[model samples]
Target: MKQKLIVEGHNDILVISHLLMAKNLRITGYNTKERYEKEFVSIGTGKSNNDGGKENALKAFKAALKTEELDRIGLVVDADSETANPAIDTWRSIRNILQQNGYQNLPAEPNPSGTIIAETDKALIGVWIMPNNDSEGYLEHFFEGLINPNDEFLEEARRITEGFVSDERNRFSPTHQQKAKIRTWLAWQDDPESPMGLALRDYPRLGYMSLDTPLVESFYDWLQLCFDTYVE
Candidate 1:
């Protein structure tokens, strides 16, 4: 029997999926369009609200689990703005719901010594939690790692993000401050050349055309990795 693995990650999963699909990997429960739409709407409207995307993601995860012989499943969530550890709280909530529904085999935090509670025959290999913040550079670092050094997608992504941020209407539009910071930083990149050089340039406005290639490539890679590990 083939081993199974499920990764429950933040919106970055969408990016990963797009990359993987480009490689022709068979990934389940990933929606590149939805991810793009969410980002576009959030930036355009300046609202932090994810609407029903997360909920829909959860539904997709559940459906995948039911149909696949999942050998290992990892639940990934992001810690919200309030520093009270929203990610952990969300995990606990998910755990409760699973328990209520008679599903189990979840690993506790600080793994290795953590006990696994198996409520059902199917057991999850692990549950990993990663905090999603604009600062501290996880997402940016991840993107940088994925993007080719010569790729223009990075610049374009920055521009698109900047365009939204520079618009005064979006400055206070409920979007995460970190996202705003990224956009602002991208815009600053286009300023007149100076002694400061390109060391710390800001982001600029990335048009829709600029995002096509990189977005597709990144999403495909992510999907392939997930499918290889998770699909039965």
Candidate 2:
């Protein structure tokens, strides 16, 4: 049985692929135009460009439902919230999308683990909001959570990052605090200037924290439960 995993951007595809590789689960089919196959769960960005937000994500999902080879599907998108509060509205909107796609019985709220997985007549569907199911943020927020609190420089890093973003000349949006945090931490890495995906992939070499953090463990477990097998 084949599965499909949909995400918002290229970085997301790279991050998830690396995560799976860390667990010895090699991806069997890379998403090249004519060679794409269903032997392994297919992973791809929902939009061809950066414009593929939640709406396009849903469009991609509905489109995937039409594929005969897909027996399971998983979605990962940034919550895009303004605070660390629960993303209730975000989850509700997603549930509505599923309902429109013929799944009428999704849970009223995200499960405690921030994962939603249920069987539809055609396939198994699962959703994970980036950062966390409850958080109002993006993948950067999730990476921020992976940083070890006990690191001696954590407080100083926070202070300097907060000051940098607060500076008028930087002109950074206050909502992008997670981005600032992760970027600041990355600056301390060996490369000192890699993107989020590369930063995560090079964590071991850069002296950054590992991806095996608690939250990441839960997420990997959810991935295993959702795409690691076939139901029928």
Candidate 3:
């Protein structure tokens, strides 16, 4: 009778919530941290990847297997390619659980369109490994792709952030360049220091940020397909 989505951290929560609002779509899932009384426990204590969010997600996934009243459950995780294959590792674990729960014919890998696991008398499971089904990146990469091609500010931000290596003050990992670039771009926006969630929600309202990009459209389509029947 309920639909839920489990995301990595507060950033995911903020971005997803505002993106939905910007598009005039109703909130598609419960806010586990805020709606504690509704009794939909989040996959993590708080959606903070720095605080074992990945491991917590597995616990939440395991619990959902027993919550038969749930119409659908979705997990949106970053495919952090720092050292291990976060996306594949996460999927393998969930796939194991689904197999144990009598869900048959599961794919050996995550489907590019979004992975769906379902069976009679059980809640459907939707798994989205961002930045996409194949990429080994974070949610930031997803946002980066949504930046309009004509956005000169982003190009400038990229040039500066990517060139910061010569400053001898850059300490972030190379893999996190996209994160740095996006944040820098956001900081340079008309509203300085605006967050990804706020920028995403507000920019579109102010006639910026493209909602028609293939990446944007694909993400929206994935969400719709994931919970087509569960959410109106």
Candidate 4:
């Protein structure tokens, strides 16, 4: 069985792609708009926000159903809100879109493993929220979890970032604090130009953050279960 993964943006693709590589998974290549063989796992972005990206994801999911090679399809999208206490709103919005496209009986809530998956009539459909399965944040929040517990930089960055956000001159949306925090940490990297995904992949050498966390492992496992099959 060949697998397909649908993500929100380029950064999401970068993160998952690198995570797969870190686990020594031999991915053939990534395709943007074109459809490829099932032997290769192709990842496509749904744009930046939930609306457009989710729409794009539904399209990809439909396309996969038509192909005999695709046996599993996974979705990786951010919760992208201010609070996750009731992650229902965003979850419902995404769920409804998929329901229209053929996915059946998705969970009403996010899974603790950070994934909501179902064995649908079409294929195995999996949904994973960024940073965690039960969070109201984005990739930055996940990056925060991956930061080294001993890194004093994390504390210092938070301190300054909090102060900056409090300033009346600062106009970043309250929900975007995670982005501020992540960029703050990224600035200290040797190659600040490096994308967040690459920075994560090089965490060991960077010495500022460590990806050796339970959350990262959980996410890795989810990816493997969704796509790393050798079925014919």
For lDDT, the strongest prediction is: 3
Show where candidate 4 strays beyond 4 Å.
27-69, 80-86, 101-105, 116-121, 229-232
lDDT of 3 by residue, 173-226 (tens): 777788888998888788987999888877865655877777777777777666
> Candidate 3's error at 111, in angstroms?
1.8
lDDT value for candidate 3? 0.73
Q: How well does model 2 score by local distance difference test?
A: 0.67
TM-score of predicted model 1?
0.41
List per-candidate RMSD values in Å. 10.9, 4.1, 3.5, 4.4
TM-score of each: 0.41, 0.80, 0.83, 0.78
lDDT of 4 by residue, 1-232 (tens): 4567776666776676666556666433433223333334334435555434545655665566556466667777766564546346556766776676666778787776755455535666666777687757777888788788768877877877788778844568766776887787788777777778898678756676665789987887777666543211
Those runs of model 1 whose alpha carbons end farther than 4 Å from true positions after fitting are: 1-11, 17-52, 68-74, 81-83, 101-128, 132-170, 186-232
Candidate 1 lDDT, 156-181, residue by residue in tens: 65565556667654544534544444
In order of TM-score, best first, we have: 3, 2, 4, 1
Work out how many backbone clashes candidate 1 has.
31
Error of 2 at 57 (Å): 1.8
Q: What overall lDDT, based on C-alpha atoms, would model 4 receive against the true structure?
A: 0.66
186-215: candidate 2 lDDT, tens digit per residue: 777677877766766677444556776778
Worst 10 residues of 2 by lDDT: 33-42
Worst 10 residues of 4 by lDDT: 30-39
